[model samples]
Target: MSTQIVILAAGMGSRLGRSLPKSLTELSDGRTIMQQQFDNIHQAFGKDAKVTIVVGYKLEYIIDAFPEASFVYNEQYDQTNTSKSLMRALRASSSGGVLWMNGDVVFDPVALERAAKVVARDQSFVSVNTAKVSDEEVKYTTDAEGYIRELSKTVKGGLGEAVGINYVSSRDKAALVRQLARVDDQDYFERGIELAIEQNGLLVEPIDISDLYAVEVDFAEDLERANLLFS
Candidate 1:
């Protein structure tokens, strides 16, 4: 199946204390997070991979940066959350399968290639990092079989932090959209995945990527930490 990429980049990086959108923030290497993400995806899937970026906060910058990418705008981005932004992007995608990533994440390109290869087995998967997890991370707990049991920021006694990357197959895409439509506007997209896992029997396996460098840039400290790691 063909794999499309959907990036959620609508959030205002209020905690980062930056005027620029988090995805546009430059890494220590001087490439913006979005630029690095595009390069990494290209390296993993080649130039033909269809990429859609959902933009809201400073939409012009993202548009200018990725003129070739398809875009879905979230006009109410300030009032909504990632779930809403993701819904917009998913709705715009053609059916088959999609690899979704949070636009502000930086990671080893190998992780993307691994996720793309392994996701076909289960038709759904989420990358996880067990090496280090802070309380601020979006955590998950897996069942004995390695299927995600619960996923949320408040989930305690979790296995690891989710690396903000996921894959959903065409068979499950409609169901995922339905689940997303049922969630609160303020909910994270993972909330919809949690519901799909519980009610629709969607098997979202966890792909451990702890050995690889991956970080979600949310706050100023996260950017500092990412710079330290990538510098």
Candidate 2:
């Protein structure tokens, strides 16, 4: 099955206190987060893999930075969240499987390959990090069999952080679309996944990536940490 990579990059990233979009934030290596992500995807998937980036805040900057990537603009990005941006990408995608990611994260290429491998085998998967999880991170709990049972920021005593990468097989795409359509605009993309799992019995296995480096650049401190970890 062909895989499509959908990046949700439409948020303003107000917490980062940066004028530029979070995806455009420069790493210590001189490459922007978007550039590094593109390189990592190419490393894992190949140079010609299909990638679609959803843009809203500073759309022109993202467009100029990744001229070859197909973009879906979310004009109401300020009023919505990742769920809405992800819905747009899902609607635009025609591939049998999709690898979705939050644009603000930078991770090891090996982690990306591991996620891809899991998706290839299981058809649907969520990348989870067993590393130290802060209170602010998007946490999740898995079932006895290791599938995601619940996912949210407030899920206390959870297994680990989601690490902002998930794979959706075409088998589950329609259910996910319906669930996303029913969610509030402010809901996170994982909310839709949670609904699909609860209502439709969609199986999303969790792939542990404790050995890999992956950080979401939310605040300035996170950016510094990401630079140090990924550089």
Candidate 3:
């Protein structure tokens, strides 16, 4: 079954203060963040990789910017959160699995290359960084079997921060789609993942990428930090 790489770019990105989608934010490497992401996908998976973008805020701009990719519109982009947007992507997917990431995250392409192993095995996983766990970022804890247990911004004694990149195997996609739909409108997609784990015993592995550089470009400081990687 073919795999689809989903870019969740529907948010208004008001915090980043960008008039366009956050993924369109340019990097010092002379590529927009999404372009870098596309390049990384192309490099890692070759030309045959199926790419999809979930667009909402300033959807036209994103569509115009990347006319080659498939798109899904999140009609509730202004009111809903990542959970809803992700649900839309999963619902629209024709592939056996999806490898997805935050549109705003500036990451080393090596992370995706490493993650391809899990995609090959058709396993579900969430990319994580154990180097630092911040209060406002999504954090996670694993079960005794090393599968993800709790996942959210408010998780206590979290092992590390979830890096906003993830995968869902074909076998697990239905459960996630159900939970994402059941989650609160304001809840992040992590909440849906947690619910799926609790309600359906979904076993999601945590792939450690602490050695990598993947920054979600949220605040001005984060953008600076990500840009510094190119400098």
Task: Write candidate 2's Cα lDDT for 1-231 as tens digits.
Answer: 456899889999999999989999999999999898999899888888899999999999999989999999999999998898999899889958789899988899898888778767647888988877678888898888778889889888988899998988888998898898899999999999999999999899888888999988999998899988976
Report the lDDT of model 2 for residue 207: 84
Q: Any runs in candidate 2 off by more than 4 Å, and if so which?
A: none
Question: Which predicted model would earn the best lDDT?
Answer: 3
Off by over 4 Å in 1: 120-122
Output the number of the TM-score-best candidate. 3
Clashing pairs in 2: none
What is the lDDT of every predicted structure here?
0.88, 0.89, 0.92
TM-score of each: 0.96, 0.97, 0.98
For each of the candidates, the C-alpha root-mean-square deviation to the true structure, in angstroms, is 1.3, 1.1, 0.9
lDDT of 3 by residue, 1-231 (tens): 556999999999999887888899988878999998999898888888899999999999989989999999999999999999999999999859899999998888899998998999989999999999999999999999999999999999999999999999999999999999999998999998999999998889999999989999998889899999755
Cα distance off (Å), candidate 1, residue 136: 1.6
Candidate 3 ranges beyond 4 A from true positions: none
